[model samples]
Target: MERKRSNRGRWTSVATAVIWIGTTGGASGHEIKVLASQLLTAPGSRDTVYLSWGHIVPVDMPIDAETIKDYRLHTPSGSVNYLSTEGTSLHANVVTVDEEGLYTAEVIRHPSIYTLVIDETGHRHATGSKVEAAKLGGTVDYSARSHQFAKALLISGDAHEGSTKVLGHEFEIVPLDGPESWVAGSDLRVRVLFQGKPAARQDVFARYIGFKPDQAWCFAIPTDNDGIATIRVDRAGTWIIRAQKTLPAALEDRALFDLESYTASVALEVLP
Candidate 1:
């Protein structure tokens, strides 16, 4: 199970909006970012959104081919299916948004991270050999470790007026585009939401992952009472926004000296 309730920061006892991180789990070094041409669309108007998975924090290595197939876009009306993909971009067509809700271009699973662990029940050998468990619960055991994996979920959604919480989990720093979503010479407002609510006073970080005039174009911003942050887009490039937090485990998870840490991010390619 996920870590139990605690008095620690970030990972404190959750209410309706529950955000989580495993006690001893590892995270992916990459993330998926969404791009929409126009966020504020007229009712029944058609628009396009793109999904990019080659967005790794600290570095952006774009892939020359398709990296995902099950990507989608969640709108107020319904979901938009994938139309086509070019290189690392997965294109999805948004038909219309008749209602007054937020439109989100999102993906549930993107960067999958794995690790080896020692646990009860014998595991299979690397060479496809069946190995019997000589011990249980690491009692009088030889070596005990099994492999487990964790996947990261990223969502980049924004509304023209009120930003809705359509898809959000893990430690996500969603960039809320303004009237000029990704246009050059504009300031973008970003929000770091935990679960489905604003994370006030949280430290939000942004950096240019792709090519930029200055390699040191990294900055940190803090969320306000509304859990929203703002950053100015000086030049056009791939902007990466991120945030992280850690907390002590609950009583049950204390056995392994568990420490839960969560990290989340999204990428945006500002047009020149």
Candidate 2:
């Protein structure tokens, strides 16, 4: 009887150890909470965003080695498909703001509980909620600064109206002859292409880069009766522009300018 009781006690201890390991296991299958240091600022800002989390545990009952799950970040701006392998805990790098406002980071598994980061000066608010049109009224002009600028393009778009303001700077929407919507950023260039050919002497709109949430930098320029204009982008990065071709009123169809379609855009990177 004594030997049997000792054997039972040994088995009970082993079972308890297994339960403890399964319930509070490694990083996998555990939920993680994160917090950011200061709201995300402008682009090229230092990636000092800090992340910290709680403990790890199993997903369900009868926890085993396979119960361990991974962690990830879903940012509003760039891709968050990649796992967050940074920091001591499962934390991700803070996102950069091409435009100001609120940004969010959600867990891959738990979508409900997420972190919100705001960049504006006053109260915290959401980003991309307000749809402001592009600034600068119709018939924008781009004159040659020193010499006849080559490789320039024209772009335009409808404004969300007062919805666009960066660092307290207000943008005005303008009407143009062509496409609506343009890319944003300084390192990018804009050009007009027709039938796989380049158009010259076009006037394009202009705006600051990384100032808006959309990261779209472009404006509208009115074309002469000949449908010619000159526009150029001195900066680099993605850009969008709009152009419209109106039909007769009887047609009951106003030509729509898809920003994705017919905009001069380029990804530019400048080196010192």
Candidate 3:
């Protein structure tokens, strides 16, 4: 009975070792990869920067074992220092700098790949991270136009995306030429209203419609002191504009104003 029990125990030990080696070996051998969107320059004033990326961990991948330990951001002059890994994405708080130059972030996965370098610049540079590009550039444009007017209001100026507000209305601009009658490069005015009342201090955006729908020309313009916002339609066409009022911690959708509100397509008619 002792001999039988001993043999059984030996077989169990051997099987356990085999399973451990097979499972651990493959997982330990897995390589670490990095990806990013386009590199960006921090706005001249802001210090905090946001970086986002995606990573794939294969099934059976070790949680704490094969994961990245930290990330380092390097500037043209010197290293900005290392940052700890936050789940899969790497984030860093950049020190404000007055000068411009190249910057790179290197991700370190222990005992595996030397380091995956993500290169970007304070001015402009190349980036190989697809995950980062989509996160940073995945913003929608909100702009529109009103129907034809003998004399339309002119709205102009610039605002950062998602930051500027036009009274209760929020909008993004897309470039489209009206009928052949409308002149290009000339300022065409459109009326903006909210609930039949002239909305004041509204945020307006001007985005140039590029050759493709995916490309946009956008700038934010705040409404005049009187709550009216005017935008120039460089190219004339039907444009979809959005209006909204934002409250603390919430966004109010005010797209549909009163019936008397300006019509959607603000035709840029040629002056007879």
Instruction: Give candidate 2 regions above 4 Å deviation.
Output: 1-31, 48-50, 55-83, 86-95, 108-272
Q: What is the lDDT of residue 126 in candidate 3?
A: 15
Q: Give the TM-scores of the predictions, in the order they appear.
A: 0.48, 0.21, 0.24
lDDT, each prediction: 0.46, 0.27, 0.31
Any idea what lDDT model 3 has? 0.31
Provide the lDDT at 179 for model 1.
31
The 10-residue segment with the lowest total lDDT in model 1 = 141-150
Candidate 2 TM-score versus the reference: 0.21
Candidate 1 runs further than 4 Å off = 1-71, 80-103, 109-165, 176-181, 211-217
Query: Across residues 130-241, which tens digit of lDDT does each residue of candidate 3 receive?
Result: 2333344432112111221111111111112221122221222222222222343444343355544555676543332231222121333456665555454444432223
Candidate 2: tens digits of C-alpha lDDT, residues 15-71: 443443344222111222223333323434433222222221101122121212333
